[model samples]
Target: MAPIVQGTGEVIVIMGVSGAGKTTIGNLLAEAAKCTFLDADDFHPDSNKEKMREGIPLSEEDRMPWLQGLCDALKERIIAGKITVLACSALRKRYREILRLSDPDHLPGRHNCSVKFVLLNVPVEVLSDRVNNRLANGEHFMPPSLLQSQLELLEIDVSEGILQVDATQNPSVIVKTIGDSLIQTKASESY
Candidate 1:
């Protein structure tokens, strides 16, 4: 089956705490949707990566530029007419707002671009196990010790236009659920 095509100017953010399979699921979602996949990690500065490696949670000041960079990249893709999927640990509502808003200096009329967030909800035990395994395998820079800090900062509000899914499910199944929901959402919005 063809992947569900997102509406024009829409950017999808696969968001959750660490070990919620953001990268894995985001890549699959982008591939299925025939869009570009962007990992928020790639946009992080060396200092941010080092802090995370040392098990330090970043302060909002440390994250501001990183969020702005992601925002710029999303804006570029949107202006170029490409659907982009980003995997990010947008753990707080304020952080998500930063992503959704365009830098007024750069794009004056594009405040709060169309963004859909997919929050991957997983049990704490499962999330811990995943983090431990990922660290053991040296798959990512985020240390397992920082997972608690991330969860503590996570804000899951329904008003944020989030589609919550069980992260423990098969990746394909999860992707299908997101795709189906997007389709229905778009269909309703058209009416």
Candidate 2:
């Protein structure tokens, strides 16, 4: 596959609710783009993981610090001139804004950092099945019971310039859709 972005310092965030194949697609995308891959779940605090493991939904307060940490990590990669692909369940608009790496209050003048978010739009039934399967296989910590909470928290705004891809499609097809969208975005911006 051709490089998705021409240069380093680009961050692609593969976002969705749990079991939406964010990690799977993120790894593939990072390999295809020849960049780094960071799984947001790896950065989650133990407390957050415990809450989710117990099937208790986390509040915004439980997520702010985690989001900030991810933002910082992404910023660090950008400053180092390294491309990074992150898998994050950025369920809310505000959460995504935090991950954009351009918050003036925190990192001033870092607006030059290019961050794109691709939302994996999977049906609730598919998500539930995936989550249950992962749980049965002991592949993840999150309990299947929290899927509804995550679905409730999900908010996709058309104005956010997020690229929504069908998660039900083959992983390669989904990655290609995201890549094509990025190429088009770059092409349009050049004009």
- lDDT of candidate 2? 0.86
Which 10-residue span in candidate 1 carries the lowest summed lDDT?
103-112
**TM-score of candidate 2 versus the correct structure, residues matched by position:** 0.92
Which tens-of-lDDT digit does each residue in 32-123 have in candidate 2? 88878999999999999999999999988989999999888888877777788899999998888788753223443233337778999999
**lDDT tens digits, residues 1-191, model 1?**
26656455678899999999999999999889988899999999999999999998998889999999998888877766678889999998888887777422333233334677899999999999999999999998889899999989999877666899998999999999998888888778779
Residue-level error in angstroms, candidate 2, position 114: 1.2
Computed on alpha carbons, the lDDT of every model, listed in order, comes to 0.85, 0.86
* Cα distance off (Å), candidate 1, residue 99: 1.1
| Best by the lDDT measure | 2
Clashing pairs in 2: none
